[model samples]
Target: MNVLLQVADTAGAACVFLGAAICLLGVVGMLKLPDVLSRSHAATKPQSLGLLVVLAGVALRLHSVMDLATLALIGFFQLLTGPVASHLVARSAYRTGQVERGDLLFDDLDAQLTEPGQEEGQGRRDSP
Candidate 1:
């Protein structure tokens, strides 16, 4: 029983550590990515999943039912919210022309961000 408990503890710790590392990787990727949309994708996908895995590891390590329930709730909420938030942000960025889509690759949002007066649609960020 003791050995089994130790193994469980080790596994949980490993999961948590690995999840954190994955999150850091996502952050690094976001920083290293060339464009805003790409960075947002890095942030919204791998990092969100990494958070979920970390929460699961915490849930595994928790001894109390309440703690487990809380962790599960957090995980559920994150899973539900993360993608929606990402989509909204990405859409807003595309709408506002904040993302750069230059290069000779396939593009879809090209028309949305580029028009005669569309550049001004982003408005003044200097406004108080």
Candidate 2:
């Protein structure tokens, strides 16, 4: 039992450290990325993943059921909201012309925003 507890504690500490590193990478990505779309991607993806990892580490350390439930809830909300928020930020940036169209290889939103009446069967426009 003592050995198992020590292992769990070591694992939890490792997870927490790894998660913090992941989040730091995300921040670096945001700073280094050229555009809003890329920056938002950096902001959400790694951050969400890091947060979940951190929560998992906390769960391992905390044997209490109620604390685990709270951590689960936090992870759930982070997963749910992160992408949605990133999407909105990217969408607004694109709409405002902050995104350079030429940099994109394929533009799905172009048809929808430029020609709203176009049918879905028309397919996405290839960026020139």
Question: Which candidate leads the pack in TM-score?
Answer: 2
What does candidate 1's lDDT look like per residue over 1-128, in tens digits? 88977877888898899899989999998889987678778988888789988987786677899998898888888889888988888878866678665652766656644645547456433446
By lDDT, who's the top model here? 2
> For model 2, what is the alpha-carbon lDDT of residue 56?
86
| lDDT of each candidate versus the true structure | 0.79, 0.90
Q: Estimate the TM-score of every prediction.
A: 0.76, 0.88
Candidate 2 weakest lDDT stretch, 10 residues: 116-125
Model 1 shows how many backbone clashes? Answer: 0
Clashes of each: 0, 0
Error of 2 at 95 (Å): 0.3
- lDDT by residue for model 2 (5-84), tens: 89998899989999999999999999999899999999999999999898888877999999999999999999999999
- lDDT of model 1 at position 72: 83
